[model samples]
Target: MTTALVTGASRGIGRAIAVALSERGDRVAVHYGHDREAAEETRSLLTGDGHLVVGGDLADPAGARAVVDTALEAFGGIDVLVNNAALAPSPATLHKIDETSYEHWDQVWSQMLDLDLRAPANVSFLVARALISAGRPGAIVNVGSRGAFRGEPDFPAYGAAKAGLHAMGQSLAVALAPHGIAVTSVAPGFVGTDRQEQTLAGARGEAIRAQSPFGRVATPEEVAAAVVYLTSPQSQWASGAVLDLNGASHLRT
Candidate 1:
């Protein structure tokens, strides 16, 4: 069976990815940042004998090692790695951003850099290296955001970080190609996760929907299906690409 390691598997799109992989008979390592209860719920929903949960704060460099090591020990090896965990919506303007305090511009930007850009790149490299050392081929799917291409005026730092992630994915794909590893980025528009639903209940949500061609947002399952496809052997020839799962919502200029 194929072994897939999925980060941020506690909820939202991450949980859906884990379930889809498991349903397809792939062994899954559900990685969680904090929510153990939610992680356990995801693990319980998964089928098959080798499905397991591994939790750690991936924002820390060492935590990244712990996550990979545990999965390796349990699954024997990994064939796919999904970098999906992320923090969101810092809610600040460019000029208003202060570069001083812990929650200010610099710190917030650093946190976003660490989690969104650095963590994914680090994980991809380590996993790719492991597979290369063993003379095996693998897949790396980095969860990206439409904000990386479209400007998020309210969340500039996050947009910047995701933009960096998009660039990183492309570079890694080329760098790891000779090593027999495939790397790609999946950029999605607004999804109907719990947090996203709550935000939609707030002001400006209706207005945003009205602008989209679909007149609605995407569901977690829809995005999860894309992940499963890209990570599967069926998509082996499709790498170093940015697959837009955004339903043409960002097409309107």
Candidate 2:
């Protein structure tokens, strides 16, 4: 049986990914930042047994290590890793230039870069090392953002971090290919997760939906479905590839 660890699985896209992985018979480790109750709820929504709920503030390097270590010890070894945790853009996270103070700008940039980029790097390192030691071929998928390709004027740090994440995945893919490990990323434009309900219902709802020709935003399950394929055993050839999940909203040449 395959064992997978999914970070930020307490809710939103992370929860959906966990559910999808569980339904496909892989033992899942659901990692949350500081939401044990929500993680347990995700654990409940899972399809099968052997699912685990882990909590850690992954922004901290030590916390990232602890989460991966616990999962590795409990599962003996992990075959898949989804670095889905992130500091998404919101009212509180927004730091636009000219309007925001220098101190606030520095704070947002530092926090976003640390949690969104460095933490994933740390977790990937730990899990990849574990898989190598175990002599196991595995997959690591990162949930990046379309903002990396487009632009996040209000959240420049987020865009930079995600772009770094995509590059990091490609680099890891090449480095781990000889060991039979694959690394990939999915860049979704605007996902209508539960947390975005308020924004989706507010003034930006129509404009957000209109970004796609389908007149709708991507769903968490849709993203999860893409992950299911990328993380599957047959997709080893797709290593180093970054798949776009936007609904014809943003096209990259």
- Per TM-score, the best of the predicted structures is 2
- lDDT by residue (1-253, candidate 2, tens digit) is 9999999999999999999999999999999998899999999999989889999999998999999999998999999999999999988889999699999999999999998999999999999999999899999999999999999999999999999999999999999999899999999999989999999999999999999999999999999999999999999999999999999899999
| Worst 10 contiguous positions by lDDT, candidate 1 | 91-100
Error at 178, model 1, angstroms = 1.9
For model 2, which pairs clash? Answer: none
TM-score of each model, paired residue for residue: 0.93, 0.99
Q: Which stretches of candidate 2 lie over 4 Å from their true place?
A: none
The window of 10 residues in a row where model 2 has the poorest summed lDDT is 89-98
- Tell me the spans in candidate 1 whose CA falls farther than 4 Å from its real position: 90-103
Please give, for residues 199-232, the per-residue lDDT of candidate 1 as tens digits. Answer: 7888968876765688878889999899998987
Q: Using alpha carbons, what is the TM-score of model 1?
A: 0.93
